[model samples]
Target: MSSFDNTHITALTDLINKAVQDIIAEYASAGRAVPSLDTLESGLFQVPEETPARLTKAIQIVEAACAQLSCTVAPPGSVMINKSLEHEEPACLLVVTEARIADLLLDKPEGLPASELASRSGLDTRKLTRILRLLATKHCFKEVKPGVFANNRLSMKLLSSDTVSSIVCLLTDESLRASAYLNETLTDPSERDGGIPFIRATGYPFFDYHKTRQGLKKGERFPRAMVGWGDVTGKGLLAKVYPWTSQPANTTICDVGGGNGHVTMNLMKAHPHIKVVVQDQPQVIEMAQKFWAKEYPGAMEKERVQFIPFDFFKDAAVQGCDFYYIRSILRDWPDTESELILKNVRQAMKQGSRVIIHDTVLRDAVRTPESSSNASVHHDVAPEPLLPNYGVARVRTYELDMTMMNLLNSQMRTLPEFIELGKRCGLRFEKLYEVGETDLVEFSPI
Candidate 1:
């Protein structure tokens, strides 16, 4: 479609969304039951049992009214598609505001009214007012009055003061920036530079910049974020997938490239029988010790888990561990770098040991279109045809693949790609486990 057509479609979609929101609001105001999907699909505000002809005419009227709006009323699947594509302005706004609000909420846990927030953020009050209104509508914040805002459950979850939220802040911004340069980065050879990739348009590789940021210092927001994500994913993976409890009593689980020992700690907590060793860069290991040592107290004296300051890329120091668990680390590098890391990891593993690769994997699926019940129908026009299902996960994976291409020179590996890479390093690919649609592929020394 032409740029004008795209703009027109976006405008029309926005109008329909606004109309739908208004209809729902009206229903809320009236304390009446909201109309059902069947009612919407039939194009009649209310079903008429007795007057079939009038019902048909009303349906025509409703369809016509929607048609007059000059755009397709997106189907349920299309809503998800729109979200995945980040096509809607509101979606992007939501993401940006969520990040900013999370930072603000962490810095000022007491929270701020919209006026005060606008003042502190140096944002225009009028624009901030509009944005907050949108956020409040989506339950991101609670609106006490016309211009006042307060933290709601959703907003609180984004706070950097917490571990997961902090990591979310770091990753989400990097994701956005990478996405912004996706097209150019993919098409241009000059985009790739010393593992930095296309995001250099912003002037530095993400890791280099991330390392330099004051927020990333030991005991600062970034490590806490990493710890938070590690805690969440580690616990979830251990409970759902890994058989940590089934391992032998003498087993030593090495978390290679483990950050802040979050995963190691969680694994230790879950499988008390398993001794854990976490290895990473010297700086990260030092911070990891300080954070976990303080939190666990005498557990370090007891040696529940040992933090080893060694880079997995440099040498395989923590060898002969029963299981080598690497979570979400390999996906950050390209095939060549990943091969190098795997080779190093392989040198550390024993004959019977397993290497667990845990990260997000994509699947292919198609979208289907349907009409919106929330839209106001004009009496005279015909409704537009619904859009076709473009496979969603495929699109998302490609987009993310391009994003990683730009930001870290990494790519999301397909099942076959994983197998191929493993073969090159003399590691045989083993069974794959499903972790909420993401495949956790196992590798062993061939």
Candidate 2:
């Protein structure tokens, strides 16, 4: 690997040019205009599925190259200064999202003045100006003049109607509060509940908090927020990554803890031949049934997909499923509970059965990634001087890791860690699928 110096500048430039040209060619072929930074239509932040894969990689490379170069040449205190001001960004977002400032500015093409905005929103004018200006500098909003703000594409997406806004509020509010207590959990082992920070901050486990949280029917928001987050960060990777096309006509997949069965809905929509049984708690299953009834009536009526209530901790009643799929479930518990969840799924398997686990498979900066050792798991490691695990490019890996610890005293696992846990329940490693922010590993009876 080359040092982080100008010696690699030409190579970076060439890579950037190639990706740019490739993207332009695709747009030209499609008879579409190349999108600009001023517009949200072209960016990769929360792209639609119809976007071309090569273009996504191209945009990512451009951002990574620019960021890597900027960091390398940055003077002392650059990193530390960034760390110190981190809280301010989330605070700014929390204010705007909660206050519905984005919605207020949405249709005002001429831009909204600060004083008027404050009057309408019932916020103090001076305080609101400071908050909006901070985010406008980062392209989230546009400061048309000294004290006027307008909704740009990024900010427009945060309108009160958007679910991503709810996610932003949730992460930066309760989740953020819980994150501040991580050290308390790590060090104060003797303090009650083994220092689980989410429980410490919210007085309820993460899932329980979602179930009992009161608001605009808080029960519905958590699942909807999850789908929004998955779209923004992951692009519904589970829907895209699996080889659903290859599944046999009779293939059956049991979606364990599949809240509202959104993932299964996507799968059934894409691959009609694959049958699915989505399981969750009784209440969540009720929600899923209503969802399927409204959104995918055919799938439910045809019996190609259905929602069933299953408590993951109990012995399995689901039998003869070709694939038992779990997503974002295990990371909500420590190992002992996680093992029990696996053992229950184990009890229902027959020959040719496989369990597909969809969650984050964290890679260490120093250790070789499991993808290198397993032909089945495919992912992109950062090129050249960038960290192999994508460094700052994928810091969400660690962010979610902390969130897991804060909420449940659980963890995102390394391959070896996952293997060890699976082994405890008479399951063996079968294969792995590297989805976006998460991984899908298949395990079978030893």
lDDT by candidate, in order shown: 0.60, 0.78
Cα RMSD to native, each candidate? 13.3, 3.0
The candidate maximizing lDDT is 2
- lDDT tens string, model 2, 1-446? 54655666666677668878988877887886676545634244354465666776676677766766666667749866977788888888988887899888876867999899999889999999999999998888899899999888888767878878878877777678788787876788587655788777777766677677453344465655676787676645676778878889968899998888888788878788999898889999998889899999998788888667888898584888999988888887789999999999989999888888888898777536464665755766666555567666677788878877776777889877888999998889977776756788889987
The lDDT, on a scale of 0 to 1, for candidate 2 is 0.78
Best by TM-score: 2
Candidate 2 segments whose C-alpha is farther than 4 A from its true place: 1-5, 8-18, 40-48, 207-220, 234-239, 367-373
